[model samples]
Target: MPSGRTSARRFRNHVAAMVLAVAATLVSGAPAPVAATGQVAPPATAPSPAPVYPITARIVARYPHDPGAFTEGLLWHDGALFESIGLEGRSEVRHVRLEDGQVLARAVLPADQFGEGLALWENSLVSLTWKTGLAHRWDAKTLKRTGSFRYTGEGWGLASDGKALIQSDGSATLRFRDPKSFAVQRELTVTANGRPVRNLNELEVIDGAIFANVWHRNYLVRIDPANGAVTGLMDLSALATEVAATDPEAVPNGIAWDPAKRRLFVTGKLWPTLFEIALDPAP
Candidate 1:
């Protein structure tokens, strides 16, 4: 019923509208086959990132620690603490008294070797050397050098989960090895907020979870051993600041957990004090 000119104008308008819609879609790069109602649905929302719960350290007690020792690894066994002190020429392993921080026994490493993480496997105590790819075994009771084994990379932190020996090579990946052969059994990549977490040092296995120190950082990350996801982060900024006040190089580096007492202790390289702490949910 419309006139020819009017019909032509309407057709042209329809073409123009279609072209505009296509242009808009192309410019936005949004997916569309226009909806049934001719409206584009919103783009799917991205999944939320995994949560990292913050943990606050509550000081339970404080014990004197050696300010001269560059502590790299620490662990508690029986009633005493075993520590590995680093620095190429000054590296040593010491059996320390918890009550007085007394060095009851000590074994100095080779001048060429820089000691790193320490862990106990059954009756033997195992220690790692930085850049040497060597791991040393000692009698847990006597601290006598029993033997040595070879590994592949730089050893930053080490811990034993009873069965396999877990080791970190300053990378995000943790390797689990056969206790006797030192052969790598499997590996787990540590992650925080969907990104790899590197510089993992001074490891301690607490209640089946791996607690690691990020090198030069003032916090400890609690990692899920099965999946390597960071479930909790314990901030030790105050403790680090306290130690750094006297010695700026005294960054946090040690973690020792007494399973029987359920007590957790932490210290730093060249720190004068070691703290017994309990983690509480951050406010």
Candidate 2:
């Protein structure tokens, strides 16, 4: 009989092997062979589709010189804009005016930690710190540090559904956690057109669907909440090209929706413009 320690080690090794095998299969484009027994064959050995969408997007409004904010997270509540800015020694959470880009209230993070994602739950604001494994909660109205929680992995994106919190790292996985305790409740891998779309970041939950920004790309994907399927894609290539021409470091990384006002907002890292866009399904 195996000892408890040895059994635990073996279990961990098995999990690691499974993860590596999946990664290898994804990268090599080789299908796993099937045996003689009646079993379904593996997927076809083909490269995944490129991370480009063909949907048309029109910018409804754009504001220049919005602090050149290294945007990590964005949210809109009750006619106020909440934004989280990243980079160590320069991280801040600010309440801004939606009409014109003006900081109304702000709270700065410590100098050593880079901010990543944020969400608004109840009356508090929650934010994650990149590489720090720490999540901070603040009083939304006063900007006072209310509490803190710890989580594993690199923080990338966050969203809330008026119940649980949804988060993503740089992987293809989306994790759902309890808001108060910060305990992971469930997880799922995101698939785009039958292929896994990794590097998922900057999340927003709107109308029961998960919308995420694929980091370093000019696309935002609408994911089915139940099975993580890519149902629709929004192409922001024009906005990306324009931002790149003006600022090469600008990368789209924030998304927020105001259901009451029926509006959407998007911005990028170290960007000077925050855009309000109206979404209309293509004919």
- On TM-score, the leading prediction is 1
Model 1 residue-pair collision total: 0
lDDT of 2 at 190: 82
- In order, the Cα lDDT scores of the candidates are 0.80, 0.77
Q: What local lDDT score does residue 34 receive in model 1, on the 0 to 100 scale?
A: 37
In candidate 2, what are the lDDT values of residues 1-283, reduced to their tens digit? 9998897567545533433443456568554444222222334221133432333355788875374688889999768888888888989998988778789999999999888899999999999988889999999998899999999888989999888889988778899989999999999888855667777789999888888887655667777878887665665665776666355446788898989866789888876677888776532
Candidate 2 colliding pairs: 70-270
Model 2 lDDT vs. the true structure?
Answer: 0.77
The residue-level lDDT of candidate 2 at 61 comes to 86
The list of candidate 1 runs beyond 4 A from truth reads 1-50, 245-248, 280-283
lDDT of 1 at 249: 50
Best model per lDDT: 1
Q: Compose the digit string of candidate 1's lDDT tens values, residues 1-283.
A: 9998897567545433433442344345355233222323223111112455555457889999998989889999979999999887999999999888999999999999989999999998999998899999999999999999999878889999998999998778899999898999999988765667766889999888899986655678788999988776676777887776455456789999998988899999888999999755333
Ten residues in sequence with the least summed lDDT for candidate 2: 38-47
TM-score of each: 0.80, 0.79
